[model samples]
Each structure stands twice: as structure tokens, then as C-alpha cells.
Target: MRISMWVVATFLLAAVSLEAQARALTQNQQSVCRWGSDIAAGAQASKLSGVSLYGARKKLQVRKFPRPWMRMTALGITEQTYNSASRLKPAAVKQTYYEQCVRHELARR
Candidate 1:
């Protein structure tokens, strides 16, 4: 009986640990998605205002860029201007934007 109780206790602890890990992973993924979306929007917006990526980065700061996801979309529409001017690929730029957004959001929290 004692052996059975010990096994059950161990199983419960393992299950709890697994649950915690899963929750943490889910939160991390959600954060990444949110950040990427924000960066893309910001990039698009900057493009619309005739701001080069370098100029925007300098002016807004990567973390302070506004409506990042929307900006990214705008860039997508005007690929020639941004693509020719920026050193980064669109996806890479978007990821960097997202990372910055995530950091800023976390700092705010």
C-alpha cells in the first residue's frame, strides 16, 4: 500500500510539472507572435511616411516604433522602396521589429 501511494504521488508531481512547462511554452509563443505582428505594422507605417528603415529605426527606436504590424503590412505593399534601402530582408526586419516590440511590452509589464 505504501509503495502504491508513493508511485501515485510521484505521478501527480510529474503531471503538475508538465502542465507548468506547457503553460510557459504557450505564453512564450504568444509573446513572439504579438511582437512580430507589431514590428511588421510599424515597418509598413514608416514606409508610408517615406521614412527609410534606417531613418525610422533611428527616429523611433526599435522598441518605440508605433503600430508595428500595420507598418510591416505597408512595407509589404511598397517593397521596392524599403527593400532597396534597408540592409535587412523583409522577414528579418519583421522579426527584429517583433523582438523589439516584445521587449518593450515586457518592460512595460
Candidate 2:
């Protein structure tokens, strides 16, 4: 009985893990994620380049990134994330963006 219970538990865990891993971002989603992610990354990284958060957003708008202002609104990066992570090194910022974008997209499904 103990062995059977353990096996069942293990099987259930495996199934749930596989299901979570199975959902993938579509091609368009990959593109959109990259677009938004890069924009956010550039904005955040700009602090090192001497740009303020507000300045970065305006520059992005003048350069025509979709919803530059709204990226901090609901359904996107929180202001806390934008503010706190402003000084992350470029590589770390990129990984952070990729993970956040992936998690958000997956949860939307």
C-alpha cells in the first residue's frame, strides 16, 4: 500500500510538471514578447546611460514603440519592477525580462 501510494504521488507530480512545461509561446507571442521585453530592457538599462525612467518612456514613444507609456500599467511590468530593477546589469535584465514575459504569457493561457 505504501509503495502504491508513493508511485501514484510521483506519477501525479510528473504529469503536472509535464503539463506546465508543455505550454509554449507561439511564434507571434515570441515576437511580441521580444518586442516588449527589449523595450522594457532598454528603458531599464538606460539608467546606466543617464536616462530617467520618465525620459526613457518619452524617448521610446517618440521612437514609436507600442504602448511605451502603458508598459507600466496593469497587465505589464509593475512600477516596482521597473523602479527596483533599473540598475540590473544588461544580461541580468534580459533574463529577468524573458522570465517575466514567459510567466505572464503562460499564465494568460
Best by lDDT: 2
Give stretches of model 1 more than 4 Å off: 1-25, 60-81, 84-109
Q: lDDT per prediction?
A: 0.55, 0.61
Candidate 1 differs from the real structure by a C-alpha RMSD in angstroms, to one decimal, of: 13.7
lDDT of 1 by residue, 84-109 (tens): 45655546666555454444544555
Best by TM-score: 2
Worst 10 residues of 1 by lDDT: 72-81
For residue 88, model 1's alpha carbon misses the true position, in angstroms, by 19
> How does model 2 fare in lDDT?
0.61
What are the per-residue Cα lDDT tens digits for candidate 2 across 1-109?
A: 9999999999899757644543477877676666666655665567667776566666644553455554444223423445673567766676567667767878898
